[model samples]
Target: MSALERRIEAMRLFGRLVATQEGREYLADNNHKSGQAVVVADYEELIKDVMPRIRSHKPPVTIALLKDDELLMFSIGPTPEAERVSSSAASPESTIGMLYEAACQTSNGSSFHLTSWDRDATAFSMPSVRELLSH
Candidate 1:
């Protein structure tokens, strides 16, 4: 296989892993051990409300993940830029809900269980964690 194909497969595999319980456990362990900020936010209601209005925005909506204080855009998103520290998430159809949907489909109906921290430093709510794991 070609290098590009290999990379693509690797990314797909990474997404698949990240969507699983074992992947989550690994991430949680690394986060705790390294003191990294694994930001989680409650976008359930917020995304639902904003999605209708923002679905048609000029730029596509982008959802990023917080890994060790670095912002990595979801590889499955429209732009799919993974090497960046941060990028614009300007969107209409690019709402967090859309990302969640893609993540869901990618994970074969499993939950993303991951969330992004707000642009500003913010704490994730226990309620959000409960809701995420409960699902």
Candidate 2:
């Protein structure tokens, strides 16, 4: 197989692991060890309200995972909805982290019908301990 094919398969495997953990009770029990962000906001509700705005504005969005103070496993693309908003100005990291949380909630079915403009631009999906676990 070619390098690109291998990379594609790897991504699919990562997605599958995420999907499996996301849908199953076993994964739910294991979620505590994963160190996922303790989201304080009503992300589902927020995403629902903001998605249309994001799509319309087409602001740049970066999908990212925060590993300590550093960002790992990230991807960048346009978020059209963000373009419409009057953001006073926030750090790029803060903005991307917010977007990542929204995307995660949306993908997991907590928030329905609001798809990200660029789901493939993952800032952090590689070498994740949870993703590497044997199912």
lDDT of 1 by residue, 4-107 (tens): 34334434433553577765664454332222222222233244444343334332332333322222332221222343333434233344435544444432
Per-model TM values vs. the true structure: 0.24, 0.25
Model 1: lowest-lDDT 10 consecutive positions: 120-129
Predicted model with the maximum TM-score: 2
Q: How much lDDT does candidate 2 score?
A: 0.34
User: Which run of 10 residues does model 2 get worst, by summed lDDT?
Assistant: 36-45
Task: Write down the lDDT that model 1 would get.
Answer: 0.33
Cα lDDT, model 1, residue 108: 24
In model 2, what lDDT does residue 34 have? 41
Each candidate: RMSD to true structure? 16.3, 13.2
Q: Per-residue alpha-carbon lDDT of model 2 for 1-135, expressed as tens digits?
A: 443343344445434545764523433443222433222112222344434443453333222233232222322233235333322222222343455444444322111122443332222122233434344
